[model samples]
Target: MSPRKKIVQAAFEKKKLNGVVARVGLVLDISGSMRNLYLNGTVQEVVERILAVASKFDDNQTLDVWIYDNEFSRLPSVKENGIENYVAKQILNNETLHKFGRNNEPLVMEDVIRKYTKEEPSTQPAFIVFINDGGVVKPTKKVIVESSTLPIFWQFVGIGNSDFELLRKLDEMEGRFVDNANFFHLDDISAISDENLYDHLLHEFPEWLQAVKSKGLVL
Candidate 1:
């Protein structure tokens, strides 16, 4: 059996999955920077990546997604929610970061983590794939402090010229994976071709998933 199959089984027996339910959450970044021609448009790149991953799962599996910049962006434009639609809608509108009452935007990774744990207690092994072209905008400590108690696995991929050292530092930590914690830092979008991008996603997904599973998560 596949790793995903094994995990679904183990998590079912343990009754720790959030929603008793959806096995995954793909949190994508639809920030202003993704509008550039980095990857056949940011939305296309992300949508394609997600679809590929999802295609590998069992037919019965379900996954939820959220795109964030200023506020949380949902997917599907009268269509299946994925990288493609999200990119076209959010990117074209250029409102990826339209937050209210805030002079500056904050990274929602920590908040999303807490919300998942609280709103969907049955959702286990809540994996958050945080994509960004900028900094978290919130303090590193705040990200951890604001996170939920649920065990969240983070996969962060940063684009653009922003400082990615911090994101890298978080992923490499030896302790428990915290609220703002994640897996990668692909800072220079200009450098990553389609092959490079897809390969990174394919390679990292298994490694991180396995490592997290080895730690014995409920999922």
Candidate 2:
């Protein structure tokens, strides 16, 4: 096994998620402010790391990908074999989708909900990793609250120095059928070790799985 995949598998074992089966998706912030991260290869690294998690968690070993700014594009799904230069090939070089613009969380978020709940419904749960540098809006709360009962778990990661107030307060958000999201902040994702990063990424997921299973959110 690849080293990163081994690290992710170890993380799953540590979290007692050894037998869990789920779909994995990645949402990247392509807003104007994120230009540096993308250009510096940070976004590509993020894709590779998340793809490792998908290698272990997803039955098909594929990672569904989406990039969003004011608008969103559902790019082709990523498999471990094709992870080389994924961000550059799929997003930067691909002229078909919107590039860096302003942030609009609700639009892309709603589409993610539609994909998992309507287009390709599944008995297995979906674990979505949402990466944003900042500028999350209030409208996003409505989408998260409304999608609370669905078989999707949102793991929001704030990368950069932004306040991320709304993301930071996801746990305290009200009126959800269940707590469907978790948030963590990192000044620089690449600075973290693989083991530590996987630990943080999977931290709240097991609890969310237990809660959702008891509520029949996942079959």
RMSD of each: 7.2, 0.8
Give the residue spans of candidate 1 off by over 4 A. Answer: 1-22, 37-40, 57-63, 76-86, 90-107, 145-149, 171-180, 187-199, 202-219
Model 2 lDDT tens row, 23-135: 99999999999999999999999999998899899989999999999999999999977989888888889888897888999998888889998999998999999999984
Q: Report the error of model 2 at residue 5, Å.
A: 1.5
Question: What's the CA error at residue 16 for candidate 1, in Å?
Answer: 21
For model 2, the stretches where C-alpha displacement exceeds 4 angstroms are none
Output the worst ten-in-a-row residue range by lDDT, candidate 1. Answer: 96-105
Best by lDDT: 2
Q: Rate the local accuracy (lDDT) of all candidates.
A: 0.50, 0.92
Q: How many backbone clashes does candidate 2 have?
A: 0
What value of lDDT does candidate 1 attain over all alpha carbons? 0.50
